[model samples]
Target: MSKRPYSAANPSPDKTAKATVDAVKDITISEKASDEKKDDESKKDEKKDDKEVSNFVMPNYLDGSFHWSYERLASAALIPLISTQVIYGAHPVLDGVLGLVLPLHLHIGFDSCITDYFPARNYPRANKYMAWGLKATSAAVIWGCFEFNTNDVGITELIQRTLTA
Candidate 1:
């Protein structure tokens, strides 16, 4: 084996061994410190995540945050609306309300499907186009319902007429 070149800066063998031990001890201490830091950081992250999840603010009714609530309320409203229509027969007010609510309920359901199937992260262009198309279709449908309720026999009458026929 080639001998290492010795210089004034180089320590003697015993001193070199002591120095190596001290370096190892320093490194181990530093590693422990770093590990503690990592644990602290991870704990902080968990706390932040918990805070974010728990601090939900109710947004405006028009916002996506309220979508599930709106959908559920609309669905619940339908049971009473339909029940009243069946028991009391056709009323213009009920027909108009049904026309509005039914189209809106359908729109919400279809919008959810589009959101699930064409998520913006995976299909940005398709998602945008589909969302706009859905908006237009829903608007047209709601408008058609309004027109029919105003100018024709309206929705409940049409349903009754169809069921009887």
Candidate 2:
């Protein structure tokens, strides 16, 4: 029997091998392009999510505003606090102001610490009531200290005597 000459219809082993390699290279290139497209899409999605998060505002549950301005005022009050403490017994007015303000400052600082650790998001109703109760208690304490300063031997004097003794 005579062997048929290789034609377009019947590729030789060499041609078939080259065709297979070329097909694989094309498939690999296409797959790499698709992967790069997917990566670009994911990066765009991440940027969108980041923008949304930045624009989002946390809902306020409290009745009144705790403005950033108040925080600045609280920070400024620290100067007087340190000055009064150092002087200890400069004047009756300073002692009385210290008596009221010191407790308030302490309460605000403590409440902030508590709020940071035990956020309102965790227990909405409980957190609101807890914060209100803390504020009420702080007010009462401040009032009592102020009264004590007015009625008794000023707060600084009392503390100094106690510390010395």
Candidate 3:
């Protein structure tokens, strides 16, 4: 029996493929280092972003006389507008239904509301029940609008079914 001498140009010292394994390990380490660097950079930016956002301060409305800056009014109005959409669902009756659905806009009783029909009277039981029912139905309509893919036709038909029900 005999053992071979070392060779470098075409190395195969142990024949166990240690060099291939070492190359793979080095590649994995380099990838891990790059990932760590990315995480560090993102962490730094997150802190800087928080500081930048904190700089945009606002005073309270408890000061004597009232005033609305563009930012203030816009913020105030935006919430109710978004809520109105979620509250009432799509406007099948009119295009730009945001404009029409507002009580002030499309006046008379043609500006129908479930609130109008199921008026909140003084009775505790009826009032609570009606409130729950309306909320559930409104939530259903909003969900249905999101789930449905068709145009206003399907929604209008749905409204008709609800009205008949």
Candidate 4:
């Protein structure tokens, strides 16, 4: 039987080696191109992030040390205020003080939640107006509570009766 010079069953070692080298070179070139694209994409993403951060504006009330301190103090004061109302039972003075602090606390806490969910950036005028409305409503509520406490069973007692009954 005569042997073939270049058959599929008897492939040359040099040809196989050359093919393998070419495939490797092609793979390396593609990988280099992909890596450069990834680097460019990452740089673009970083620039977008920097622009967003620079443009971001925190609310004025949230930015100040005095507001932070006041919020902290109000939160701390609630513990004692609640404890006194619970243990000693509600007095006129306690009810009056609670009326002042509690409504403000509720307004601030709810307004903060509203601010977080519905940011000023999305609703600039609405956010400001909403906050003002909250403050005004809270003030009115406090005033109403004060009037009720002076005229009737008081705020805590009224809550107790409502719950029990």
Candidate 5:
């Protein structure tokens, strides 16, 4: 065997027989840690599935309207949208992306007040339309604020193609 000097980055120690045992023990610990991480990821996946299911449950509207009123819904969204920028100091672009990508977060808060706010009760229906509208609006609002419609060359080209189409 070729001799290699002790490197701290490696588990092996040099100049002592005990170093071999230490290296073996270190390997076992690392393997155990890796196994634990796999277990954690499996657990996270399970939780994610559960959350997805719960997110789609129909609301308790109970009558001609939803659980909340339009005014109340608007106020609810206003709080978070403002707070995210004013208090939490989220970048406007990042905030807008979040607003588009996960519009449901804001939608849910507002749903407590809006009669029409529902999740995917029927695919490509009311809830789906609302979600899509919110996403589009969020993107437009963010891009407008950032002057992206004027400043972004890529967006301008894409817009030209869309307009031509």
Candidate 6:
């Protein structure tokens, strides 16, 4: 066996022996503390489960269900928009509609993702900031699309040229 390092705290052989015993006691105490912590967490989860069903409130017209319908409608609208572009080729009106619809669709999809990942219940501040940021970005995107359609060759023509090139 290797010689044990002497410390000022454990000066004598008896004290050194006592220190080893204390170390063993500490390990058991730490294990018990961890077990207690786990039990507390489980209790919290049980309480959460018990209180899962909350009292119903009056449905606000501006809730997620309202937005969910809009999301579906936007998605449905895209199929016809895309089909028209592919079948009839590009038109200024079609490009304008596509520009508006596509960004709105993308914004709604990303908003849903942000709401799912950064939920207001868990991350209130982050969720609020993210929602605001998404709004600002979506506004900017719509503006840029409007400028492109008006000032440039428009979205559908750009895509057609890009793909052909």
Find the candidate with the highest lDDT and give its number. 6
Weakest 10 consecutive residues of candidate 4 by summed lDDT: 58-67
lDDT of 1 at 82: 98
The CA lDDT of each predicted structure is 0.89, 0.77, 0.53, 0.85, 0.57, 0.90
List, residue by residue over 33-107, the lDDT tens digit for candidate 2. 999999999999999999998896764634325634455577787687757666755467777777766776777
**Candidate 1: residue 70 Cα off by (Å):** 1.1
lDDT per residue (tens digit) for residues 1-165 in model 5:
987666666545443558777889999999999999999999999999899878866655555245346435655665666555555453545454444434444554444333244645444477656656766776565566446534553332443467679
lDDT tens per residue, model 3, 4-29: 65666656655548877898999999
Q: Which 10 consecutive positions of candidate 6 have the poorest summed lDDT?
A: 53-62
For lDDT, candidate 4 versus 6, the one ahead is 6
Which candidate would rank higher by TM-score, 2 or 5?
2
**Poorly placed runs, candidate 6 (over 4 Å):** 1-63
Clashing pairs for model 6 are none
Considering only N, C-alpha and C atoms within 3 Å, which residue pairs clash in candidate 1?
none
- Put down candidate 6 lDDT per residue, 1-165, tens digits, no spaces: 977677896487988789899999999999999999999999999898778756566666347886788899999999999999988888889888988999999999999998889988999999999999999999999999999999999888898899999
Q: What clash count goes with each model?
A: 0, 0, 0, 0, 3, 0
Which regions of candidate 2 deviate over 4 angstroms? 1-69, 88-90
**lDDT at 7, model 3:** 69
Lowest lDDT sum, 10 consecutive residues, model 5, at: 149-158
After superposition, the stretches of candidate 1 with alpha carbons farther than 4 Å from their true spots are 1-17, 28-64
State the lDDT of candidate 4 residue by residue for 29-144, as single tens digits: 99999999999999999999999989957567657555666777888888898799889887889888888888878877887777888789999998888888888898899889
Candidate order by decreasing TM-score: 1, 6, 4, 2, 3, 5
RMSD of each: 5.1, 7.2, 20.5, 8.1, 23.9, 11.6
Quality of model 4 by C-alpha lDDT:
0.85
What's the TM-score of every candidate structure?
0.71, 0.53, 0.26, 0.58, 0.24, 0.62
Name the lDDT value of residue 3 in candidate 6. 73
Candidate 1 TM-score over all chains jointly = 0.71
TM-score top scorer: 1
